[model samples]
Target: MAEEAGARREEAPEETIEDDDGYVEYVPVKKRRLLEQQKLLQRKGQNSSLVEDGRGAAESKPSLLVKASQLKKDQPEISATEQLVRQEKDMIDRLSERKTLMSVRELAKGITYTNPMQTDWRPPSHVRHMSEAECDEIRKQWHILVEGEEIPPPIKNFKDMRFPDPILRKLKEKSITRPTPIQVQGLPVILSGRDMIGIAFTGSGKTLVFVLPLIMLALQEEQSSSLGGGEGPFGLVVCPSRELARQTFDVVQEFTNVLREKNYPELRSMLCIGGIDMRSQLEVVKKGVHIVVATPGRLKDMLAKKKMNLDRCKYLTLDEADRLIDLGFEEDIREVFDHFKAQRQTLLFSATMPKKIQNFAKSALVKPVVVNVGRAGAANLDVIQEVEYVKQEAKIVYLLECLQKTPPPVLIFCENKSDVDDIHEYLLVKGVGAVAIHGGKDQEEREYAIASFKQGKKDVLVATDIASKGLDFPDIQHVINYDMPAEIENYVHRIGRTGRCGKTGIATSFINKNQSETILLDLKHLLKEARQRIPPVLATLDDPMDNVEEVARASGVKGCAYCGGLGHRIGECPKLEHQKSQAIAGTRRDYFGSGGYGGEI
Candidate 1:
């Protein structure tokens, strides 16, 4: 009988066991292991000197009162840390209260002013708006200009801007106390709830210029019970490319989290771009989102499928607006604009404002306040630029030689995907740690490449113009245009990726005659202004547009209506293809009118 009982016990499951209570109970193995760990930790805690006397013997830590008293006496650092935490919590609570109050005021105002088109409604009489001269002085001081209109004065710091306490504290925690030039002028305009066109160089803190105000506006609207009632997002940030959209999404998410931590309503953001599962994005939208950062195509796809809406999207921002337009997103942008019905505020931010961008802004923004930090199409002055007049065939050899001396974290921009891939492969084969990012790569590969580059896992990033604009990797030491961009403005954005946020950086370009002719004058001017070496090849080239002969011939202004010549009028001029064709046709008609060539040759 004893042997049979032993055999039965061996076969029984370990989860259920009989105790002194004479009952069976179930306990998982994981639970048992966790219990063991807890008991071991308790034993160690009790043996440590940090625990106070007279507390329970099994208690693993000191009493709050004891810890506080000791923190005040023996550890000043601990007290200061505790004070900071408390202050952060207190600020969150206070901001929450202020948000609630603002919501109530907005609700009351809505009751009185219900017109949808009344975006120009004035604030109370106590508010004193900045005068034109004052605004101009502020702009002049910062070397900025706003389109012939007065704006709210620039802020020197977060406190001067009167941002919410939580945001201010968060800024302090991040050690970003001082405002950049763009933020100094851009923030006040955005906060005024007016449409704005902000033009600043890359990495000039343009993201914050729009993001901070969007957060405040969303919070206010949320408190007033204006958002979250619809399937549409309250804010839409349209980026030119998927990488830029992803980076901007991160910034918006970080600020959104800060607002959530302040006890405000939880704000959800969705990043909609290609190279991802469309169904997954749809599901995220279905769950509810308040803000969207997206590329144009994917955003249009979502709209077509009815997965998302922009009916209630009050804040519309175009980051890198020029790039977005140049990349053939203008039609989709217009379509997206048509969906908004509410009193929406539009913001267009770009590094350069060309004529097309200016026209787009005119149609989109209603009397926008244009803010330009520096000359349009100009490169950031912080970069040390170098132009080498290398032959096309020897460009690769020169690049390899340059890499031998260049430091890590170098970014090389090729003109096309093939070159990007070839250069990346060459670098890898040479035992150099390198990664590549371009439109040709799928979403996963692009993400991994960017992640590797950003985290210092990869020392070199070989890319095309797709990585040129609005993708912030702040620590890049050098930018090399292995193949110079076709557009002058692209060169500016490409190099602006380095020398970010007042940090000095180096930018080197390989220029050949074929690539330098059209932009020689502009390149010369840029090099001279940046105090860089102007190559002898570049110095000898004349401006193609400035030559009087070339201008007269190329302007398409027909000096002679008949012959299209500058020396003679239509009647006296010789070479006229249209006139010759017409004269031949008339002779043929006269012959045909008498009797046709008909069957004859």
Candidate 2:
């Protein structure tokens, strides 16, 4: 055996190393198991003690607490750079907080001032004052959790909130017989003139929660002092996408039209979005509008050009707040905040806001009350989620069958615009009705597609992630993900297109090996939480536990608190990696959005 080995070594040209004493043969991991590497230390010409293990286990294992000092020294540049970033952020936060505090105080001066028209929002003592048993029952029935002091009771119905006759008539016409769960709790919070962060599944009537109260705010401001031309937009609804903004604009216009029909003073509201005529928007702005629903990009552009101002703007609603803060819009939002002239009654609404972003959002408000229905970032319970493993190539063929799982008005979501086009064309060629929309599509085409789908002129709507943001598609019977989204939050939003307004729906996702294990891990946890049947693929996924508790050191959190990703702790989150920031273990938030970062948002 030795002779054969010697011959093989000679034939293979084994790597030779020269030591202090003489030349020696070096073993490699490819040639031997790592544990056997220690045998090399016994070689004749090797320095046994200095080159212990030779395989470098010490260099590979994560740093031991005892050797952290040495590791810190070894990574001088990385450590120093991280420290510099941390310190700089600390300084910026301090300065920003000071300025923010001043702004908050300036806005708070007349915060207690009440609006005359807003009185209808509060019902009589019998309805306004809820008993403890009733409150508990409401919470239990709706799976609602209310936090913060002096929160108003959730209205049992529209009449309990004392809506104006116009609103009642509109509700009756639309057949919205009662306030939705979110509206039930959310309307009272905003009507109470309190800052709010509301969490509910998409299509849970969240738009009405913020929109209804803002109308009252604008009318109140106008009643006391009529707004002059080019003088006022007392309420602003900021949405993450143009589609979402347009939908919100429609909602605002619908209710505004209802009020107009009742012969109330004209309360003009307009859509401030991109792809529309700038001249037209400016004309509306010049004539003065009471409430302006806008997308951030167009809003920022208008602000930059000084075409409009928020001098009288006090009611600010961030629809799909999480998406607004994320997607590189945080700076733009802070810039918008600078335009606010008073302490605005800010409201944040979304289906899936990460805990960290929620905290970051609250930093801009005063005593914000959080009203969570079911669980934040959770899949809608009304929707049945079906996850299936399909070969990447076969997904197209299987699409036809998935459509059969549900009736008409199915929404199919793809990650790529190209895929959307491909699917839309394939469906059309196969004799199925389909409409597609993506960012690349012209504004007119996108609007047409959405309108046609909403009107039930089309049986299917194929789109990209943009459509998944916050567009409300009524009575969608099914949502099919052509490809699994990389972010689980996006997955939650995509499925939410169905199962809206307390209606049952179905969601089918086609996944394969190409998708990352981490995202699948999140999907797995989400499904488990919702009590959905775990497919065999997801059921067998092994979720690795973090050795060190990150945000949870104090609160016992076992996963990421920032993005709700369970595959990694906050320190290792890929979402935050874009910032090139490293999280120091067990530190006060100063980074992931707030203090007490360990708990759920």
Candidate 3:
């Protein structure tokens, strides 16, 4: 009976479904018992036509991502802004598609400075291979030390450094008789095309170290081939703050202007920062830029908008690296880095290099030379640090008394914007020349305040920690901290505003019961390290740094090595915890949503 049923199935012919074109195929599907077996045995047929119009199908279109990928392909109408952006993207794509003509490696990379530089003046290898005593003497005299394999010898004088006469004359015009400690060693490392991280005091001429090399780099690139429209930024300077960026831009302009006056190939530079006209920056970039000094936000925005490209950028300098990360520009910085297809000779310069930052910086560069002028996070010896304990209510009143200690060109730092304004208003009412700046102020007001202060029109510039990050004030004699900063690194920066450029200055900080013991502990150790006078309130705080090693070994939290805070370990660190919470809160928003310190200041 089973054989008979199989034979009947073979004769049924229900499996092969044929189309009108006569092509037939068998589709095997699960067989189910049905009450109407005869109806289930029917064959299924299809319309055989598979062409576009032959089938019931509509015309296809490019997907969102597909349409987005084609920059110049036919598409629907777009706005003027979109068209401009598309043009920029097309320009950047063309730049990236250019063929590489040569392969290069670090340590000069066969790219010698010849336009205005004298490579014939390079010191002989034997002279470069100085005896240990001579090297030690140079380092000791400058209080600078370097760590790396095959490190370049330090430059003794501006003349010995192979700099073009024009650059040297410009230096002399600026009254810079010789190289600072950082410039002594830093210039060689950078000029050799090696990546480097330079640590020095805030006012120790760190800017020149990167700037001079950048100028030389751009000069060489121009000598080989002039940058066409939408081509350059052979070098990039990333500053954390706008004021610092502008200062760098001015320096670049000064040197580039000197070169231009001498009738050298014009090296164009642009300052990309907030509060500036974007159209102006776009014009500069469109014309072609040899160097760009920019704040992280504006630079990142430009990169995102495809308005600028870093294909020709072989030199990258991050000024105030620690502050850049602290202000939450690390991601933006790395994103800006993604645009570089070629290798970059990266340099990171700052007054402080924390343990965490040091590690992260290493990962960003290719075998960097580390040149440290003093202990990382250590206060400047030129500044006399004094901590005073005062009640929160009476702190503002005592500020007047503190201002009397220093003459014109004073910086008063408060932790809050309201406090900065209140102090500024109070000082004005009390007949003290004061101007205020913070995150809350608009660009015009902040620039005016900084200009007033720098030109010495305003003796007292009341500000927050924003002013402390890499803003150079050569004549600042005193720095008064109205309320202590939350992080110890900020303390170093606040005090660093004074005591710059071979001059002695004073840094006075006020603390109250509201201040954290962690901050106090770090303050105590910093003062002790600097040999400054520690007040009674700070002196009473136990020194966590004393047994830091033992505690670190026991707890495995490393005892706050990240910020050099002696009061706690990494696990229990309030600053770190605050960072984690801020990161979780979506973005690193400032305490008051102003993106300033605690309260937008």
Best by TM-score: 2
Q: Per TM-score, what order, best first?
A: 2, 3, 1
**lDDT (CA) per prediction:** 0.73, 0.79, 0.79
In model 3, what is the error at residue 108, expressed in angstroms? Answer: 28
Which stretch of 10 consecutive residues in model 2 shows the poorest summed lDDT? 110-119
Write candidate 3's Cα lDDT for 1-601 as tens digits. Answer: 9898578658975555455899766444444234235564442112223233465333344578886768547667776545544543343344233322122332225432212212223555755779878877888898887887667788778777777788889999989998889888998878877788899877889999999989988998899889999988899999988888988999999998988888889999999999988999999988899999999898989998999999888889999988887787766876787787677788998987766676667656666789999877778899998888889999989888888887778898988999898888999999988899998999899999999999989888999887988888989999999989999888888888888888899998888999888888878877777888878888777765564454445433333646656455554568767866876765645544766654553
TM-score of each: 0.69, 0.76, 0.76
Task: Name model 1 segments beyond 4 Å from true.
Answer: 1-132, 148-150, 226-230, 544-601
Which residue pairs overlap in candidate 2's backbone? 107-343
Pairs in clash, predicted candidate 1: none
Estimate the Cα RMSD of every predicted model relative to the unseen true structure.
Answer: 35.7, 15.5, 16.3
**Local lDDT at 69 for model 1:** 94
Inter-residue clash pairs, candidate 3: none
Better of 1 and 2 by TM-score: 2
Q: How do the residues 516-585 of candidate 2 rate in per-residue lDDT, one tens digit apiece?
A: 8888888888888789999999878776643333334443443565666656655556666644342343
In candidate 3, stretches whose alpha carbon ends up further than 4 angstroms from where it belongs are 1-126, 129-133, 549-559, 566-568, 587-601
